[model samples]
Target: MKTDKKKIIVSVTNDLVSDNRVHKVCTTLYSMGFEVLLVGRILPHSSEVKRQYSTKRFQLLFKKGPCFYAEYNFRLFLYLLFAKYDILLSNDLDSLTGNFVASQLRNKPLVYDSHEYFIEVPELVHRPKIQSIWLWLEQKILPKIQYAYTVCQSIADVYNKEYGTDFKIVRNLPLKQNYKPAEKQSDEKIILYQGALNIGRGLEQAIKAMNNIDGVKLVIAGDGDIREQLHDLVLQEKLHDKIQFAGRLPLEELAKLTATADLGLSIEEDLGLNYRFALPNKLFDYIQSQVPVLVTNLPEMAAIVKKYDVGEITDSLEPKQLADKFREALFNEKKRKVWKEKLPFAAKELVWEKEEKVIQEIFKGITR
Candidate 1:
């Protein structure tokens, strides 16, 4: 079958060049013979430019203060006006409006990729008015969208059941197939956490857990709104040596750090629908690195942990209970080795290659 060799424009509200979901999809589509154009902003005076990849990035001016959305929409509108694309792939609800307008003008098919159940994001949980508005936009836009995809099964099911519209499931698995196997380190037992340090991620508990464990270090990678508080917690606990926050390391360095870990962490608090069904990238990263994961006993996370027999899960929410779970996971070598042994099988099976077929099928459907 001759695949569609077409130019695909991916409109992302956030910085697409930095996002894992967009990076995965763009790389996959490029491999499948689509020219991917990533339209988004580059940060103010940030010279950290990535050279390789088929993606042609368009830089939008950085906007300041509370009226950022207005500026974002304006820049996006201009990009849509000029850029020529066969298909416009919208990342989330924020970019859907621009895609809707662009598609209407260009008469191109639009694909809405939902990375989250947007209304269930932490930012929207409190602001009911904004939540209602966004939810309404989603309801209106999603049904009208010709092609759509989401991160996990739970999210896809929710969209289907709620909107009565069909969409594809594109799991957020990384392209890399092999990684360093889990091995015992002599100097420092590293407990790795690599994801957005959001409100319900239980970073505080992890910090406290560090206080209990000796000769062990907690490596917190990545950043978010809760980062400052986490830093403050480390200082308060006098765990400067114990808890090291290396914020937002690049993917290569991040993987290297993850590969060297004694154990991986993915402790998201059970907050809303998203957190309840959280399928984090860090879990698979841990798997690929062949490190045993110590994660929360959430449905999505537990399934992976149980299936591979990798590490432990804290079924309870209490900080002390979490601390105990961490102690047990970090201290035990035998169980960690067992989890390590099984990781190769799990890593091979649970990867982007397995998920690619479904994504390809969706594109085929759209093309036909």
Candidate 2:
């Protein structure tokens, strides 16, 4: 991990502390005998980060919206233009523009890591004009790109068809675990949900379902757009004691709580293709923690639960129906035993170390 031995510069738009996926990517690059310079933006409320590799976070005047994108991209473009690196790695569409422009100008290889279907996310699906702008950029740049990867196959298939690009799959998997399944001692349960508390994440339904279920506390971790609203809803429902808002914790701290959960929730509504094909980090984290998952019938999430026999699938978004499924997932002892036992197997197979092969293959082709 010497400073003098690297050739890659990675860029993203988020405050770097909570972005475990990008952090893992940089670590992988570092592990592959390359020094990595991870670049990002720092917000006023962003927590401090300490990592082995180098990082540079810009302070932007504009926090969000069009102005933010324009300003960040312009700043990133200038930084990447002069930075000493042979390869550029961009995470998601928001970070791609500046990296793309800089890569083209400097004749360096650019690798795109599309975390989700950019335009199909709930934020952009309703806004035609804004979505169209991103679509335009994606269409113009993707085809000509030589190297890229995405989180799941469903999204990769979409991009492969539309842009005729050969994008590889590097899912948001966690590092391998050495966890032991602990027997539950209390009748009380913790039904945990972690990740962005955004719209269409099924947080509202899960919160509402708490009223019908007894002796189970729901722990929601992470922050996002709908955080305040979800808190207000819990207060209104008078389920404050039953629902605990743990907010955002460091990666290590979150896993300790996840390991104690009787059940983990990843019930995202199919608001658009983004949610429908979603394979989020929390699902894998749950497996690593040896917690059984309760995921939606969405293709990617359900596929993991089914293939691994580590969890169950739910087709309902209603509170009462969801409550029923929650009860079964939590209390069905025979099924719970099988799930808890199978988690180690699933965790071994779907780990970040296994994914290093894909990373090596992609970089070999482009780095040459």
Question: Which candidate has the top score in lDDT?
Answer: 2
lDDT of 1: 0.78
lDDT of 1 by residue, 1-368 (tens): 35557888886765543477777777777777777777776665433646235444445454543255556766676787787668778888877787787788888888888888888987778888988988888888787877788878888899998888887887777766556554656778888999898898888888987766688889999887889999999899999989888888777778888888888999888778888778888888888887788888888888878988977988875767777787788777787778768988888887887788877777767677
Question: Any idea how many clashes model 1 has?
Answer: 0
Best-fitting candidate, scored by TM-score = 2
Q: All candidates' lDDT scores?
A: 0.78, 0.91
Number of clashing pairs per prediction, in order: 0, 1
* Candidate 2 ranges beyond 4 A from true positions: 1-4, 182-186
Candidate 1, clashing residue pairs? Answer: none
lDDT of 2 by residue, 1-368 (tens): 23346489999999888899999999988887787898899999888889999999999999999999999999999998798898899999998999999999999899999999988999998999999999999999999888999999999999999989999999999998788765677879999999998999999999999999998999999999999999999999999999999999999888788888989999999989999999999999999888899999999999999899998899997999999999999899999999868987898898999986898877766655
With candidate 2 superimposed using the best TM-score fit, by how many Å does residue 332's alpha carbon deviate from the native?
A: 0.9
Residue 310 in candidate 2 has what lDDT? 93
